[model samples]
Target: MKTLLVFEYRRGKLTEANLELFSFAAALGAQTAGVLIGAETLLPAYPGKLYLGDIVKCKDYNPEVHADIIMQAAQKEDPDYIVFIHSSYGWDLAPRVAARLKAAQVSEITGVSEGKFETGCCNGKMRRLVRPATTKAVLTIQEGAFCFTGEAEGTPAVEKLEPSADGAGLEFAGYEEPEKREVDLAKAEVIVSAGRGIGKKENVPAIAELAKSLKGELGASRPVVDAGWVDHNRQVGATGQIVSPKLYVACGISGAIQHLTGMRNSEFIVAVNKDKEAPISEVADVMVIADVMPFVAALTEKLKQ
Candidate 1:
């Protein structure tokens, strides 16, 4: 099999999802090529033909333009499989690539073997197998779903590409930098989440200190995020980010269904609330009922030992 990976860069490097997709591609034992579109001072070593470019450096993004850039490379490379990471860019670009090539698209594919692909449904509660009818396939992969294949043997041969995207339907607008993240919550092993039960923003240190003692990342519920107690990036719930940490500590969370859907898959759940009847109790492996502040403070003090 021959594969083409369209990579999106983050901070002058391949995004984590792109790296993971590359790992998946390498494991398929297929001949692989890459088309990277961005300006990056440094690139990780890859073991394939790499068409690196900076065409979008000064233009507003138009999916048609990106699709054309990809297609120009595709015409030269003629890959049997074109792969993308299911990111904001991927959502826009994949369909265009698929339509132009008149190929079947297997989206959010989590696993692939023997020409069969696996995907998740119902917010990852159920799995389904997909087999494309076409000889060639265009795939978009979900983040964190695939195991990374080990690094390739040597650096890839790099070539420059100069495909231009004509601004057809969109124009460049002003850009705003996103909020800086305090932590990478998705990679955290343990997470301590605060909900409305935490009482006030000033009392957050009591819970945060406890999370610190446990060597866990501090997460916030929607209310906590809305109340300006934490950055929106640290918010965890249906409206926020979904997390699946090794240990999930729910501090004063009422366990709304929206929040539950985001974290129900966590390996171990420990719920703490003054009200034992809270919905969170249903999913908790261990439940603690008490005034949240005193307990958090005492636990924080104990963990100092």
Candidate 2:
């Protein structure tokens, strides 16, 4: 099967997620290739074939124009599967490309078998596998679901495709930086995430103390953030900042699929919850079933000794 992996050049080079997509495509079958749409193009390190197109005039994210460019490349390659990383750009462009090609599209894919996909269902309380109704498919893979192993051998051929984009009456405006975050949790090595089960906002400092004792950043579930127990920037879950820390300590989190989807990629997970059946336990490396605040308090006290 031929797979087309579309990549976005971020900052100075292709993103790690882009390479992860290539790795995923490699396993999907043979004839793996990559496509990039930007102001300029470069040969990717992927061993499978590479396609690059220099998007002229437009410099920012215009889904209409970028999707058209990818569609042009796809027509030449005629790939059986077109894959994109689940990012702001990919989430927007993948559907457009799928519509243009009249192909099936799946988003937030965690696992893919011969003809089926695995994704979270019922707010992540269950796993649902789906099989595509068509052979031609477009998919957006969840970031960090598939670990990237650099196994591409031998230099692959690079093909420069014709870049075509009208931008659909969209104009590039000056970019404005997002407000500087108080704590950039994405880079933290260890994160202690608090959930609503911590009882009340007054108990938050105990969790904070545990985080301090562990020398980690303090994060929160959406509920905790909504309850004002922590800043919104410190929230860790879907619709919040995604973190891939070396250690993730989830305190009282029920492991809602939205939350699990965000931090399940952490190197090691330790969940402390009274409910043994919590969904987070499925992905945790260590499960400590107990009252949330007392455990944090005890851990903090013991660490002080």
Candidate 3:
């Protein structure tokens, strides 16, 4: 099988999601080529063919122009699958390209099972494997689902494509910065996350103390955030921030798949919950089967010493 990866560039640098595409392609055992609708100078080092469309005429993120450029590359590559990262750029451009090509489109694929793509359904409460009915398909991969550890080998053979720059009624507007947040969990080296099993709001401070003693940031599961025990900024789950801390301490978390999707990539996980069979234990390096409150208190006190 052959795959065409549509890479995105922003703010003068290429997004890291481009590397993850290679990992996904390797998992699928497919031959790969890529397209970048940005400056040729920003072209990544790849082992395969790369189609570059200069950003000057294309203008940063004109969906119509970007899709046109991708379509041109796809025509030459004739890939079975055209893949994109599930981000604001992909969410807009992938559909436009898919509609033009009349290909099947899948979004936010988390895994591959037996040559089928696995995507979350019903707000991530369930998972379903899918195969496109059409011979050609468009796909978007969820960020952080695939980790790329390998280094690039061999220089990519570069091909330049001319962009038509027909924006199709849409005007190119200046980019706006996202609203600033109180915390950026993605940068945290260590995170101690509270779950519903942490009990009442009063017990949250103990968990915070544990995090502070460990010199880590405080994180919370959806339930803890929903209950107002913590701010939404500290939420670590599908509906919140995705984090891959060096050390993650999940306290009293039952480990819903939604929650796991956010932090399962942590380098080392330590979970403290009363239930040994809790889903969180599956991903944890250390699963402490104990009550949440007393265990947290003891651990915090010991850390202080």
Candidate 4:
């Protein structure tokens, strides 16, 4: 099988998610090639062939033009699968390329089982494994689902192509920066996340205290955020931020698959929950079965002392 990875470059660098794409491609046991519509300097030491479209000519993001560049690369590579990182960019561009190529399109793919792609369904409460009925397919992988650890064997062979930028109805405008977030959970070395098991919003501070004692940031599961116990920016789950802290303490979290997918890559995990069979226990390095408030209070006191 041959897989083509569509790399996204932003802020003068390749997005970190591209590493996960390499890891995904490696799992497929296929010949892999990459394409980027950006500066050559932004290219990584990919192990496979790389197709570069100069950013100067292509300019800023225009969905139609970028899709055409990817199409040109696809024509050259003739890959069975064209893969993207499931981000805002992929959400917009993947379908367009798929439509042009007349290929199957799958989004938010979390895993591969027996040569089939695994994705969430029914609002992430269940998983469904799917195989494309078409000869070619477009895929967008869920962020943080795959970890890249392997090193590139050698420099990739570079092929330069000039794709047309004309005929796009959309005009290019200067990029606008998103509003600064109060907290960037992705950079936290340690994260203490609260779940619905905390009982009530009033008890949220106790969890925050535990996180403070650990010198870490406070994170929340989707339910806690939805219930207005925590801000949306602090949420840690499939619908929230994907984090891989050095240490993660999941409090009252029952380990829903959506929640686990976000923090399962933590170097070490400790889950405090009353239920021994909570799904979080499967990925946790230490599972503490105790009342949420008491356990958090005790741990905070111990850490402070």
- Go through the candidates in order and give each one's C-alpha lDDT: 0.78, 0.80, 0.88, 0.87
Best-to-worst TM-score order: 2, 4, 3, 1
Candidate no. 2 TM-score: 0.81
Model 2 lDDT per residue over 74-128, tens place: 8888988899888777888899999988888888788878777777666556777
Best by lDDT: 3
Instruction: Provide the TM-score for each candidate, comma-separated.
Output: 0.67, 0.81, 0.75, 0.76
RMSD of each: 6.6, 3.4, 4.2, 4.0
lDDT of 3 by residue, 178-257 (tens): 45669999999999999999889999999999999989999999988988999989999866888999999999998876
lDDT of 1 by residue, 64-179 (tens): 76677788778889988899987677867898999989998988887887888887665445679989888778888876666576763567677877656675577656456757
lDDT of 4 by residue, 1-305 (tens): 99999998875778888888889988898789999888876677776789988766775677788898999999999999999998878989999999999989988998987668999765454688999989999999988778888875567789998877573688768677655678899999999999999999999999998999989999999999999999988989876888999999999998876788799999999999998877787799999999989989988999989
Evaluated against the true structure, the overall lDDT of model 1 is 0.78
lDDT of 3: 0.88
| Model 2: per-residue Cα lDDT at residue 189 | 95
List runs of model 2 lying over 4 Å from the truth: 39-41, 55-58, 152-156, 172-174, 181-190, 213-216, 226-228, 232-247, 255-268, 274-277, 301-305
Task: Point out the worst 10-residue segment of candidate 1 by lDDT.
Answer: 54-63
